[model samples]
Target: MEEKCTTLGKLELEAQNWFVKVIVAEKTPIRFLRWRRQQRLVFVDKENERMQSIIYEQDVDQLDKLLELYKTYHVGNAKIREITGNTPILGTSKHQMILSRSTYIKRTEEHERIPIDHIYQFTPFSELPEIADVPTKQINLLFSVIHVFPPRFVERTKRNLQDFVIINEERRALILTLWEEFLQSEAPYLTKNVHTMPILISFALKF
Candidate 1:
């Protein structure tokens, strides 16, 4: 039988007998109001490969059942299958696939753990001499917010809006620019007692 695949990584998802050990990196509702309609889950495999999968409306129950396991356990061994009648958008099959269902999932035992700490380490901002010098082209930063700027509109082809914020960890500080969607989604927390709140930037770019 031909193998199935995933959307973001185009990784071949074999049938029930083939298992992949992964860690849940993120999970978010597709829409704030109608969460059951669709949802997104991002995972990192043992090889440090990242991929995203969507939970369709029809699979909401599966998501509900898997949520606790994913959140509490962090790591799991999952059996992946491909969904039929689903194709990549725009005809580009680069890194996208429709998975049928998660046949099985269980907490990954200690012996099954893969040493991928180097790929997801939280490094001190000061340790990086320059953003351009980051080997992986991605950095994970964790710090407390120092200041946040109000949203501003810029004259662009589509009338763009931007938001700015400053974060600090001890003596290190970094300025972050947020676009409209991010500003709106994070506005509440950004405007509150931000100095006391800590945030982790999982994938931040130097540029």
Candidate 2:
């Protein structure tokens, strides 16, 4: 038999308003919109790849807690557990907060807690795995700098793919291809001077 759970007490809400409050794991996209009926469904923007989220008639008190945490904390070193209605509430270990993968999607705004260094190995294991025997390969990285010919009046058929900053740290720079709709001005803006940069630099396809 399904247990009959007690419904929460009367919440002060305007008519035609369905209030829901959820703790967001990642920052929502800048361009986000949701109609009243569509709000019943989780995925708003399929291109963003943020289709997973828990959607239900949530308590307003829980929403208040979420707003408080969002405003109080900065990007790094923010505490979310103290909030009353935080889903997947407890941390697995003392150092890690285990918010489920689905909660991470369905972001409605741009607000996320970034790590200090913002640099971490993308591999699955923190330490070396004991299972598979991996073959070794001596990859020779070729380094060269192709200068920008005629900086002004630049008619780039491709995007950042046309530009190259070849360096020899025995590392190969990722070759990115740009789309026709993309402009050259936007190219410089896409790639930033980051202290911790990703090796696999490539064109971001919205679709």
What's the number of clashes in each of the models?
6, 1
Give the poorly placed runs of model 2, Cα more than 4 Å off.
Answer: 1-113, 116-169, 188-207
Q: Write the per-residue lDDT of candidate 2 for residues 20-70, one digit (tens) a residue.
A: 222222222212124311111111111121112222233222322343222
Cα RMSD of all models vs. native, in order, equals 7.6, 15.5
TM-score (C-alpha) between model 1 and the true structure: 0.55
Q: Please report, in order, the local distance difference test score of every candidate based on alpha carbons.
A: 0.51, 0.25
Compared with the true structure, the alpha-carbon lDDT of candidate 1 equals: 0.51
Model 2 lDDT on a 0 to 1 scale = 0.25
